[model samples]
Target: MGHWWDRNIIEPGKLPLLLALAAFVLTFLITRVVTRLIRAGKGPFGNVTAGSVHIHHVVPGVVLTVIGGFGAVASGRHGFGPALSAVIFGIGTGLVLDEFALILHLDDVYWSEAGRKSVEMVVLTAALVGLLLAGFVPFGVNDLSEDELQNRAGAVVSIGVNFLFALIALSKGKARTAVFGVIIPVVALIGSLRLARPGSLWARRFYRRRPRARARAVLRAYHHDRRWAGPRRAFGDWLGGKPDPPHPLERD
Candidate 1:
């Protein structure tokens, strides 16, 4: 284990990245706990207000992100400075992303269904970072042999092809597949081979004339959502508190 750590993490100067990932996850968890407590009116935590203005945590988050981002660049990756900077940046990122819905909608949406987007984004970010920490390189570049890597034309072609696959997956509206496909080309290839989402650009452009294909896409999407939606919502609510019940007028 120690040897693996030295070979994979220490040698590659990934300690800071590891620190950042830890800090990001911990910060999000802690923030959720505090917010949940505040919502329930059962904790010492309360909203920060100055006169009539409400001060969101994202304010300080942006500040910390700037300081830590520049500090990390200046500090380089070799020393304690980089590690500390990573932690700071991670904390800022957590705070900022925690209210990502507010930034997206230009309004406070915490505790609303829209707020769940923040949780999804945070989870996605953490998962991607975790994959990198697990030694998955983007675009399958790491899978090339020393000879192939040395062949500039071959390397470029490989990367370009993989990137094209990722792009196709994205066009199909398989975003998660596209993201993971960048790290593993096979994943992207699979997504590219699959039917596009019904409302996606790929479907609109290609499936429009193919009534059978369009019908299949819609059916697949319905089944897929039905299968996963419940579990996904449960997981999100477990991480961040459940959203408030819909208002009467908003109810379908």
Candidate 2:
């Protein structure tokens, strides 16, 4: 075990990354627990306020992120400084991303359906970082043989092709696929080859003239959402908390 750790983690200079990922996941979980408790009115924790304004955690998160980011840059790799800075950055990232919906919408949507994006982003981030920890290289470069890498042109072409597929997937509204595809090119290819989601850029531009294709795309999207939306929402609610009920005025 120690040998594996040293060879795969320490020797490879992945300790700080590992530490950062651990800190990031832990901080996010703790933040969710605290926020959930506050929402339930069962904890001493409450919103932070200054004067007439309510200060959000994102403010402090920004400060810490800047500090840790700079510190990491100055500290270099393979040291206590890097490890400490990584942890600080991870904590700050957790706080910032916890309220990503607020930043995105420029409003406090923490308990709204839109707020689910934050949890999804965090989950996606953690999964990607976990893949990195598992030594999955970006752009499928890791799959190339040493001889292929030695051919610089070939490597560049391979990466470019992978990037093209990823872009196509993104345009098709396969965000998760596009993101993961950066590390696993086959996923990107699959997403790119699949039909675009209804209302996606690919569907809007390409399927607009094809009535049959448009209908098929819409049908597929409906079925897909129906199959996963409930479980997805349930998981998000369980991990974060149930969103506040919508107001009549806010409803159609």
Give TM-scores for every candidate, taking all chains together and pairing residue i with residue i: 0.97, 0.97
Clash pairs for candidate 1 = none
| Per-residue lDDT over 91-205 for candidate 2, one digit per residue giving the tens place of the 0 to 100 score | 9988899999999999999999899989998999999999999999999999999999999999999999999999999999999999999999999999999999988999999
Per-prediction count of colliding residue pairs?
0, 0
Indicate the TM-score of model 2: 0.97
Q: What tens digits encode model 1's per-residue C-alpha lDDT throughout 146-204?
A: 99999999999999999999999999999999998999899999999999999999999
For model 1, the stretches where C-alpha displacement exceeds 4 angstroms are none
